[model samples]
Target: MAKKLFMFEKPLGMRDTLPFLYELKKQVRSVMAEEIERWGYEFIETPTLEYYETVGAASAIADHRLFKLLDQQGHTLVLRPDMTAPIARVAASRLYEDGNPLRLAYNANVFRAQQREGGRPAEFEQIGVELIGDGTVAADAEVISLMVALLKRVGLDRFSVAVGHIGYVNALFLEILGNEERASVLRRFLYEKNYVGYREHVKSWPLSSIDQKRLLDLLSLRGGTDVIEQAKTLVTSEEGRRAADELAALMAALWTYGVAEAVKLDMALVSHMSYYTGILFDVYAEQVGFPIGNGGRYDDLLAKFSRPAPATGFGLRVDRLVEAIGETDVRGDIECIVFSQERLAEAVELAEAKRAEGKRVVLQHIAGIRDIDAYSQRYRSIVYLLGRGGQ
Candidate 1:
């Protein structure tokens, strides 16, 4: 039997990023990782494929979104949809058993089987860090502060990290909806900002007028610093109150760390991922309709791997971050342009010398024809080969 050959083109939702754009994306990741490392996080890597049971542990990532496959033994595997879950597997298994907080960072590509909508790339680049073992609210504050500092350093003119605690949201939803599945559906409607869907879903539910109003209010609970105080009044459950207190404490820590202004207490900021057990946040910049960065405290994720540890991390979408920064604003002039026809060797020597001195040079070789003057327009100086029109 002959093996079948496949005709191919680059798949949809995947793209070849060109030179300048690619460099800009790299710069963004480098700056972010530098900032992350300075804050004590070490870099780590995880496999692209993992067992089905492991990847499926996180409730936030949908099954349909995963790029699934079967291995040689017929066991299921998947291209990781998110880095956190894989990181959790490693941390729990034996990578960080020192009992100290493990601070790790990664520059990774994640694959999603979901269709590309709104120009969303199916192959996404993520630059992120996970702070595991420390469950304190201060850890959350530090992570949030790092996010603000990172965005500012990356030259975002206007952006804010909208922060929320999932505990409060879970409690509030469970308080009204009374079941996880129903509450999840409502959470999606709110996350999508689809008020019509939310209303339609709520109409048939067994709840009072005041509770319905409260649910709508939850969706609208977003704004400046003052909104935190307002969230206090809406708390009906002890869990909600605890979440509010945690948020307040985080804000206080952020204020002390000089990043309070970069944050907005957005109670409406619930994430679709059920794994996010505590702080949840998204970064919104001007001109981009989607989040350029997001992550939250997932205290429950590691426990699924049999390592019960609290972890807080965040990931910045490298492509989105590059888009937010706009075009690369590089300024320079080529030091020399070597124009040569017969004297290719001379042109090469001149180019090499200039490049060694840390100057940009362009070498143009022709077949004893073509104007050197035409090339002079693009560079600062022109060098002639074999003394032809010697400058």
Candidate 2:
């Protein structure tokens, strides 16, 4: 027998946004868009579905998480898991010039299948910018500084950004573990922030006590500018030292941008996005348990598109950001006009006038509303044009 459908059932990890929440999101989006434009970034959009072999593979999202399908010609396609890879495709194909850096922004919904969780969204919106063609510490500093400016512009007063260099972390791991296979095992623990598991794994390994101590000391490299100095001592490789130097330079640039007070240095910070080759960072707010947004340097991604250039950017989850900002009521501005048949024309005229004056107006017939009193309470003000003379 066919299964019957429930009235209110929605797919797992999908959500509905009601009118109040919609208005709040609209306001937040508007404010952030203006701020991004002020910083010289032009907004662009890409298709929702891209060839699976191209964007889907390069997206850095796991294959199992991608929502894949077949097109009419039997070619595999995917609902974009993230905006960065798709943007890279476009930038490489059409936008990037020989030397000039491109600043592009996007606000769009991306999809990824949810396997183990019910509350996590399978489809969500992301607002982000990608800075392509630049490979300097200054480029890194600009993106981080801009992200901080956007959060502050939207009234986020208390939040922290944890900054780290992927290159440094990888170099340190290889110096100690001696192979990609062994290094990735410990790297997974850092990505998951399971320090206890990491410590136990290190202790169980056959490495010397001194090497184990060095690995354990990596966890403690989280704090202010002094953490950079501590990081330099732990890594003997030139690659590791250079990564530390880049972090130091980034911090100095951030100080000049005046956002250094909001950032912290975490030497062990890592991201699951393997494309990220250099610095990476995550932003967390006071109440949100998960990161509201993240971004990093992906100097290798554009090469997959046949245009090898440096790129870095960040994407903020709109839903998580709304949660971090707290609940707000944005439904009070609308005004309603209730009218009888005799006053229909008058009600129309009044609503149009109010709307022209930049007010939100809703016109309704008296007979249409079953409970006039309850309906009237929904708006900030109600106009009565019930009788022929207008009450």
Candidate 3:
């Protein structure tokens, strides 16, 4: 027989958000949504389940991690792993028109089946915006600036955005390694941030000292705008040069937006999202070990849905953002009226009046509570109406 499960046990990677935490998340979402709306982005939502053949293939998340199931008619379906792909599907099919860029926003829960991990969540909410159909350096700058703006609006002061160009990395790799297979090995090292392993692997290759040194130099490409100039020297191909130019242009545009101060150039930066065709970035908060948010240009994704457009966007992990913002004593402002039966009418009237005045009032019958003192402590203010008129 199978072992019985405990009542409080949740599925692997699942979590419960109690009232206080839920309120915090709600507040964060509210401010973020308002800020996004103020930037002229209209919020849209897509269905939770999508066909495995479509969005699932385009999502770039590992196939093993997708939460897949068969529909009643035997069609394969999956819970969306991220908002970007589904938004791409929607924009391509219905919303997007050629030459008119669409600014769309989403706030929803995405799912990815996790291995038996202790702290990773299988389901979490993402707040993000996608600017579809615009494919300029200015567009890239806008999304990054907006991301910085949203974080600031939500009271996050200590965060940095590291921006990079995949095109540059690819050009440099192809120019050096000469084939995708060799390039793939080094790319994995960079993705895992294993600089030591990257150096060892590059050294192990039967290349000249200069080539190996060039590969090793990719790690030091992190810093401010001058790093972009340093990056230009490492690549000889037109593609590589163009990528450097794009980063320079993006930096200029960001400076125009007054967000260049928060951004740094990382020529070696890469993402697991393989569809990122050009610039990409990750946002880090002071105390968070992982990125609180990330986004980049995915010019090829919308074409997978047959609506070719240049799109860029960012998604903030609500859980991580909340964690970065730290905690507060979220004792809500609530008033409670404890009434005896004789004073029930007065209590109801008071509650209604206070509620009409935008106050949170609870009308409690005194005898119903087992521990009145403990229960009363939950509210900010308490009123006792016992033993008749005006008491």
Candidate 4:
């Protein structure tokens, strides 16, 4: 009878990141956490599994895509597809009652069912921060500056923070359509970056020539501070104007912080965060086609858990960040590798002494002289014979 062969394989959209990549990820995360801490953000953690309803509110996560299961008691649960939702739930349940602006940070693994369009793993790491109870332009500006500093700290010299206003987009759509279903459809199309589909959908509506032009103009808005002025003319609702004003204030604040150069405004950036009600942004690095990080303001997400509080945050995809940083082999300084049989005790003592002095040392038993060269090359080690003395 032939032995059964159980093929080793990863589940679809998942993969095992080997040691080199894992180490690189660790380095990137360490730098990010260190820099974020410097800005006075305290770290927090949440569970990997959340109640299904907690994360299901975000339309970006389809029901089929969520890894859902029933607990032993028959309660529906899911592997959290995104950290923001669980974070919001936390704020509502625990932090909101405090009535203070909480600057919290977190580094955790987030599992998503969909395959990454950039050819990355489905289960990846996210290093994120949430600023709750804060809605001031100063807060937004600080967050953007901190994000830029983090990217620079992680060795990404060339990157852009694409800023947007979800409030502006929602306000404009509602002012024109008055129908929730139509606006929802338009929002989805814009979120997907399907400009062609958006235009086609708007064509069927009874919008005036001016409104039509404004709708298209909203999609066209992208660049720097000048984009804010351009957006002012296109906005027709009070919420739209407020969003534009917020963007202007945020830009001015960024200028004062001396980080304006790192930011780019894009009115069409409809992020997938359903709770986002104000300024939103995503970070993109040069030579990397996808965003390495993204975040925005969510004023009402906490209300679902019965404690309403304004909040904003950004999540850095550590795996993608590791990819952007590329592979870097870490080398260690070799002090000694002792080889001996009869003098094994002496070899061990010598290795211990070196280690006590904060030096790396390796101990091996040698059969004969020929084994020395082979062991040295195999372990990238330096061989020292006990009887022969130092060579």
Candidate 5:
């Protein structure tokens, strides 16, 4: 029988990032954490594994996408697909009992079994903030403004935070003489950005001609602040009008936050987070094909765990961020290398002295090397003669 070969491979949707890229991610995290702290968000963390019954109790998407497994005691557990639900659980249970209106920050990894639409990655490093107990349009604006500031800190100048309201589509869905379940079928198509399916479904489904036209127009309508005024004319529901008003107010506030230039009003932004009761957003940057960050308001989720309170937040994709803004490489200065074994101890002492003085030193041993010049070039280090006659 032929001998079999051994091969190594990383699991699909995961890979080891090289050192330069790894360091670059660290730099990005440092900048983001500094900004998060400056904004008064106290850092917090959640377990990677949680009871399936905890996070899955609210939304179908969350229930299905979790990386599920049985724990040691045979309890259903899962690798969290997103932090929002887990944070909500914590807020309703622990934070709510202790304090109110938490401005919490966290750095975490979210694992999802399925890939997202438009080639979104499966595993991601998520850095985020949540303002629990504050539900006003101001709270919503603060999240978006901070997103702008964070992107600028990371050297990403060309980007836009697309402000949206889930109520925009939900309002229309209610008006079309269909139950939410029926309307959800259409909403799913929109979330997938499946324009053909959306249009065909709308055409065959029972809807007033005027409502159909307005919904289509709403789908296509995305622009600067003026688009809010356009939405006021097109959407009829009180909820829809209030959503537009709230969006306009939030944009005005973003101006005060000095990030209005980065704000874009996209009325069609239907979020995957089902519990979002109000403003929702997606951050896009130039040279990157997909969203680098996402956030919104979800008031209903916390109620499922312990208490009901208004909350809004966002998460930035560290992997996608470095992909958009390429990683940085750190170069070292001229390193001092000592080759002779006899000189090794002296070289180490000298290297320590230099290191104490804040210089980079490389100590190496070479026994047979005759041409020191070749070794210097090969190691890219300066050889300091200490133990030989040159000493």
Candidate 6:
């Protein structure tokens, strides 16, 4: 009997990134790392699989959309759907004794079970950073400015960083509704940018005319620092005032850092993650429909690890970022593609020498002219024939 040919297929909603996409991913990560290192943030890594309960506390991943399984000990484990939760676990268990304001970064693949409508893949790479132990406006400013710098470094020259305070939105809901469940529902509506749904959700509430006006006003809050003045009028609670003040200070600091032009304010902006306790934000490029990166202060996340330290972070979806940047045909400048049949050793030595001096070299064996030209056109490689001596 003949043996059957074996082939592998990727799971649903997951894909094997091809070579061009992989190169684009690498470039995006390199740009992110360079920008992060400029801000004195160090790199770190955590396990891909985590205790189910640890991530279960986060509303972002608590849902069954996580890919879960049982461990050898029969304990539930989950492939992390996001990076921040794992980073929080790491900070609590490993770096708990470290000094204040630890800045750490990571680049890793995260897995999630897509609900089919989210239009996102189940497995994707996230390049992100965490700032722990500091919750001051200065820290927020530093992180935001670093984000701006990173985006600029990555060739996203026409992007904007839309900043908001979750506290402001939470405070408004708490003051008007005083019901967590109702507030969560409204938050979901706002997060989806379903202004119509938000209106419908609030219609049944017994909010006063003033509260109704305030809520409606928030939906239109977008622009520069001037938007904060409007935010103050929309939020009546003391907590709301504090959130606005923090945003004001953050805007001022960004101006001082010469990044104000790249920053914008959005009072109604809400993060999908419910743990964010303070400033929340997302970066948007004119060319993309969704955010290229997002993050916010999750002062309460570390508490889940039993340490209760304040923390903030942001992450770039490297794939989406590269897509926003558009693919470049970087293979066009290839100056040499050395071909060898009998002189493999010599070809390899010459290729290595050229590569060491920063030259692009491809060493391969070709049998005929047609094959050589085909390979050259495929890779946009320049052909160099190696014969007996120098012909």
Candidates in order have lDDT scores of: 0.80, 0.92, 0.91, 0.81, 0.80, 0.82
Residue 372's C-alpha lDDT in candidate 2?
78
Supply candidate 1's per-residue lDDT for 136: 95
Q: Which ten residues in a row have the lowest lDDT in candidate 3?
A: 1-10
Across 277-338, the per-residue lDDT of candidate 5 in tens digits comes to 88998899888887998889988888887698898999999988988886455433548566
How many residue pairs clash in all the candidates, one count each? 0, 0, 0, 0, 0, 0
Q: Following a full C-alpha superposition, what root-mean-square deviation does model 5 have from the true structure?
A: 3.4
Candidate 5 lDDT:
0.80
What is candidate 4's local distance difference test score? 0.81
**Shift of residue 261 alpha carbon in model 5, Å:** 1.5
Collision pairs in model 2: none
Off by over 4 Å in 6: 1-8, 115-119, 179-181, 332-345, 367-370, 378-387
Using lDDT as the measure, which candidate wins? Answer: 2
- Output the better candidate (3/4) by lDDT: 3
Tens-digit lDDT track of model 3 for 1-391? 2456556789888899988999899999999999999999999999999999999999968899999999999999999999999999989988896569999999999999988757788999999999999999988999999999999999999999999998998899999999998888888888888888999999989998988888889899989889988888989999999999999999999999999999988888887637789999999998889899899999999989988889999999999999999997666789999999998888899999999999999899988999987998899999888986953
TM-score of each prediction = 0.85, 0.96, 0.96, 0.89, 0.87, 0.89
Better of 2 and 6 by TM-score: 2
Off by over 4 Å in 1: 1-8, 56-59, 116-118, 176-185, 197-213, 331-349, 359-382, 386-391
Model 5 residue 199 distance off true place after TM-score fit, in angstroms: 2.3
lDDT of 4 by residue, 190-248 (tens): 88989999998888778998888888888889999999989988877788999999999
Q: What overall lDDT, based on C-alpha atoms, would model 1 receive against the true structure?
A: 0.80
Q: Which ten residues in a row have the lowest lDDT in candidate 6?
A: 1-10
